[model samples]
Target: MPPPGQDPRWETMGLVHDYLAAEFPLINKTLSLAKVNTYGLIYEWTGTNSSLKPYILAAHQDVVPVNPETVSTWTHPPYSGFFDGESIWGRGASDDKASLTAIMLTLETLIQKDWTPERTIVLAFGFDEEASGIYGAKYLGKALEETYGRDAFAFIVDEGGGFKDVYETIFATPGVAEKGHADIKLEVTSPGGHSSVPPVHTTIGYLASLITEFEKNPYPVELARDTVPYDNLVCMAAHSRDIPRSLKRAIFRSGHSNAALHRFEKDFVLQDKFYSSLVGTTQAVDIISGGVKSNALPESAFAIINHRINTLSFVNETAARDTQTITSLAESLGLTLKAFGEDVIPESFYATSHCSSQSSSTSSSKGHIELSLAFNHELEPAPRTPTSGKESKPWDFLSGTIKATYYSHRAQGIKTETTATDGDNVDFDPRNVDGNTDTKYYWNLTRHIFRYNHKNAAYGSEIATGVHTVNENIPLDHYLEIIRFFTTLNNECR
Candidate 1:
């Protein structure tokens, strides 16, 4: 909505913090709006957390940098927060700010009623999630681990919606696993030569051919990443009366179901659930750069490939193999993978790779392994290196919160744990509903995670698109609905 530097409109981050303090005293700890750099900010709202155990609900404030050309395409001004005939418009409105507002409102409402809980609640509002959450949530999450152990809170909830893109893809849509972005750089080098007296081959030419090979080869397509939570999909496919008989047979393998009927329709769009889960290895080239001048025979060429490794099993191996594959392909054209940067981590030609090294990976992979590598080699990935310290595993504390919340909301039709978010336009709320996908994060941690909020569901597709896009906005009605959802959830949990 605003240029890179300044936007006259909207509240400055400091003002937002101050406003929250003024709005409620029980947000009691006040807000910490900080910037380690000009571009990053991390904010925290500490209210009542259980001394016995803690809980966290996170939302981000910064929206994606906007594209001006596409600004006019929106129904309303992108940053205006304009309330037209129906929806409210503005950047960060839908993607996260709306959720932030809902969390704020829910907390403020509870505080006014003097509501306190058995578990402490930490409202972690991050800035720069759009920038991959490095300085914001990731940093804050690390802070918690440092202070209270890996399982600091019973759970942590962040930016995600409740439902699916289209109704047909899966019986239920859960944001079970987000593809962690593996940002990479592929570089090629060679001795420079004059273009006029060019040697038969130049570095740029070699690199160009390597790039072509990467493009021609994509990670073998796995229908859906297993991280998608196939169990939930199977659950939805089995007894969902909403599905037709022929379609249901293909989706679910019930006793009365015919495998043949589903075989022919295996290409069904809903099969994406199965496909995504089944795929463990995938490769993608994210960026490419090279060459010095048009008249010069460039000495080098390079490209960045973004790969999302399915799970820990193949990340390092796949990336190295792929990088080596690219190297071989390039060398065939006469080129190499020479890495730069003074602090380059000496990756093993024989070690595990971290393609999706985002917070989730850190938590899922490093949270335990890094802490225990030296002591427990079996737990560590291949080429196990010894670490100085010990690994800290996830706690059993989450089980209590899950059980408590489940019983608390059972009467309200909240059968969340095994359920997946399914349906576009569904009302998605994270605080107290099964409508969100945070369940998946715990699946690997706790063996099972479910949704407890049943009221409103929003398609993950719609919410996810708004995530790093221009005109990031959400409807006020949706905001109010979520606020209502949490308020009810809070009361039920009580």
Candidate 2:
């Protein structure tokens, strides 16, 4: 990846537009290509049917920056588009460029075939999805809403969930919803002093104690069948060939025995990292800062705690509750706390002891703390995409196409368990995207938003494509499957 300052959004898109203009003139003639927010690209392909709603397929143009110090550790240069007959190695190979390439090629093929759908199709490539996506998807979503009425699309697909062979079952998870997100700022203040004399606790120390409290008390553990994780588990248990009979029974009897289902999920199912994140809100103390001088005692300290709100929460409500929880804890410790940069603390902080904020919290410290809490960069989780019966056309088309493309490997006597990345049986697994995507900004534009790409693999597991990590690569076979999936989607959706 290029340096953050040097790389400009839409540079790649400009090249792509030029290439398409020269090689595929028909595309320019048939589809309207325009840039939104000066960088985000939207290519619209008008269809014959004015009555049918549009569809959108999206991918991001950016990849995470690679550290200069770690460049030498790479077997091949991070930006080198190296193909060793089996896979393509590069920073964005699997993260998003794969989808961008696959989508472009699929659209080109459709143009060559002169096939037009009855419904309109949109290809949206966001510029800053790796960052906050504020200028990219945010502006694009608003523009789309203004141009087309609210809930204008039949379905919108973006990158999030993917296919994986978990527990011997080839599960194709389509991210039906995403976790909300917020970065809460925790700042502690104190009177400064020389190194010679220090108070009983400094700002850092108080922050540390607050952090400890947060660690001691995690969010309450309660998994309902409605949550994406449990729902996905139930789907897997039903579809997989050899799940244990007891587990199958527990899932089947979930209506009668909710306790048994919850126990089974907590004790057995959530052992996987991917499944664990889906169950509840998560918090990580990502950034912290304190004194600049080594000789002087620090007077002030600050920290940013990033929170991923579970499907159960709205971002603002979650942040408010966490802030109040911290205030209560601070009061218990004989310290005063203010929130959102206010001078006077809320009266409710003293009168109420409610803890409806069932969201995860984190903190850090150097000494005794008094501080103000503030939240920024917040977004509530997306509306859940429908996957059941009548309104499941998008789900059916996507899952059915995936099955048709990948299940043939199984029919050819290929064992899915041969390797982690080899599975492609494509069972429908509707799960929440633990991380936010560009689709998060488009929630108002469409009720049917699915965060999915057929070849996406859960990271940290053996099958991962190394997204945002060192030595990122995409297998040629998996890349082909992506093209096939999109091609199938274009043909079948009509």
Q: Which candidate has the highest TM-score of all? A: 2
Shift in Å, residue 244, candidate 2: 2.7
> In candidate 2, what are the lDDT values of residues 385-460, reduced to their tens digit?
8888798777777778777766544355533332334533457788888788898888878878888777745222
Clashes of each: 39, 14
Q: Write the per-residue lDDT of candidate 1 for residues 349-464, one digit (tens) a residue.
A: 11334333444333221100000011111111111111112421111222233333323443355433223333311211111111222222222222122233221242332332
4 Cα displacement, candidate 2 (Å): 13
Q: What is the lDDT of residue 18 in candidate 1?
A: 66
Prediction 1 global C-alpha lDDT: 0.45
RMSD of each: 12.3, 6.4
Best by lDDT: 2
Candidate 2 all-Cα RMSD: 6.4
